[model samples]
Target: MDFTLSGQQRDRCASVLARTQTAFPAGPGDHQPTASASAYTRAEWSRLADLGLLGASVPTAEGGGGLGALDTALVFESAGRGCADTGILFAAAAHLFSCGMPILDFAPPDTRKRLLPRMCSGELIAGNAMTEPESGSDVARLTVTARRVADGFLLSGTKSFVSNGPVADVFVTYATTDPQAGHLGVTAFVVERGAPGLAVGQPLDKMGLLSCPAAAVTFDDCFVPDEQVLGAPGQGGAIFQHSMRWERSCLFAVYLGVQQRLLDRCVEHVRQRRQSGKRLAEFQSVSNRVVDMKLRLESGRLLLYRACDALDRDDPDASLWVSLSKLAVSEAAVASSLDAMQLFGGRGCLREEGIEAAVRDALPTTVFSGTSEIQRQLIARSIGL
Candidate 1:
């Protein structure tokens, strides 16, 4: 498994990194900003679109660059290193998940023809709505229901933690068509923003990724035409499972970039800072701590790349490998950030240096996508333990 990037992928990464560095420089005074406000930079978003970074995974036939998972991960990692802004990267991922992949995978011919072109152009923001208030990881227990109407289905219930929720133009949502049939009864639908009874709730405040606005969406007898159903009515669970496999596997690529950035800062600080007439790196303990940081970052990167390769090849162990990657990358990110703060010492605790902000940003890694405990359980199940 060669982890080396192809020349084209390397060039793309360099291009994205240059753009991100200019657009999202570190600000003053622990002054992190959420992406929801007018302060959120759509100019950067538009720049990414213009660079064709937004649709790297979509096929060329669908107006994209036709890159694969590895290429997409390279672009995401570059973005992460350049900007700690979670909102922009997560929004891009959400678009690929809800719009790009699904349209390519399951959309009827006319639906795909209508939606894919605009999505590739970045004119349409898309979201995936799966988590209900009561049913998050336990997707089988979701209570959102869709009863059949004359032309389509009447969708009713609420979905929470929807990424790109507040401003998304389309939602790839799920609901139960038969209440008693469990997961098999689930169905997927594409709900347009202005559908008769669809409403975007107020954005939820979060600990980290403040820039990525997340909110609840309510469907009050929302009318979804038959044409909007993603696949066959009973196939929603399969579609969702497939989506999660990709999400859990690849979502951490950008976070891995963040880990690399944090590691670099630690290395720079230790090389220059002094303690008791010796540089920080001269102290064995300090040097060992930095070594640990480097170790974690490298290991996490390997796991992520391994997962990406497995996904690219459609390997049988893809799901298991992805679970391992997600677990390793998320935990390593938090650990590396904490180490960065410690290495920075007094300056790290202060908000002005941006170390504290990195710590705050890293806090969410353990909870989102899937929790550490959940990942362990999945790993256990994979090995038949």
Candidate 2:
């Protein structure tokens, strides 16, 4: 498979990078979250939509850019490189891959017709609600229940750590329909924000990615019509897995962009900064660290591109490739960020330098979108472990 991007793809990447630079020109200080500013404002979100980033992967008929997995990954990487606020990028990825993808792929035509345009236009924001307080990775153990009702279903449960929860207009959530069926009992539904008995709790304070507001969402016998159901009953597991494959394959490309930007800064710093009458770049130790950062970035990028290729081809080994990609990129991001901090010295420790914030942002990459450990487990299973 040719991993080389076509001329058109290169142009798209350049366009996205230019747009992100114009849309978010602020440095790390201006981008930092305040008590009153925890997430992207409506205007900023709209700006992103205008850039065609919010709908990069959705079908063109649905008012989206109709980008495939590889193209989508390239768009995200460009955004990461241009935008200093990783939190907003993270929020966008969750909204697109984790929430919008399932509805686009599995929801009824009517539902898709109604939601996709609004979602693509930035008129509505969506969230994924799968993780409960009790169930993180284990979908079968989710306590959320969806009981069949006369009209549809009545959902009751609490979802913890919902990205974009505080501002989401709708959510693609999962609930257990038959407790006896294990994972098969789980079902997916698109629940609106103002549905009766549906409540969004206060935003949760996070150590990083604060610009992406997360909160607990509770459904107290919330009613949902059959039309809102995504895929058939008992297909929630597969649907969720499908969305995650998209996420793991493409979402981490954002980190690649982040790493690239960080590496650029480190190279500039080492070349300009000096010690003992010689530039930092002249020191083998300092130069080696920068080399390692470059190594990780390029290597991780290949794995990411390969994963995206696997997804595009619908390869049976897609999961293995995705897990490998996610693990490599996430780990590389954290390691490169730390190295950047060290290279920056005392300045890096300061919030203003943005180096520390980079570390904080990179730290969570390994945890979200399934942990590094879970990816390893999937990889092990693929190898007959």
Top lDDT: which candidate number?
2
Window of ten residues with lowest summed lDDT in model 2: 29-38
RMSD of each: 2.0, 1.3
- CA shift at 257, candidate 2, in angstroms? 0.5
User: In model 2, what lDDT does residue 214 have?
Assistant: 95
Candidate 1 lDDT by residue in tens digits, 1-385: 5667778778888998888877677676334564344324556666667666568778898888787777777788888888766556767776775456876788888888788878778778788898889988877777889999998999999998798788788899999998788898999998889899999998787666666677899999999999999889988888887776667665678887888877787888899998899899999988898898888878888877888788899998888888898898888878888888889988898756767777877787777777889889989999999
Residue 92 lDDT in model 1? 76
- Cα lDDT tens digits for candidate 2, 248-269: 8778999999999999999999
- Candidate 2: where are CA atoms >4 Å away? 28-31, 34-36
Any runs in candidate 1 off by more than 4 Å, and if so which?
Answer: 28-31, 34-41
User: Given candidate 1, what's the lDDT at residue 292?
Assistant: 88
**Global lDDT of each model?**
0.80, 0.91
Error of 2 at 63 (Å): 1.0
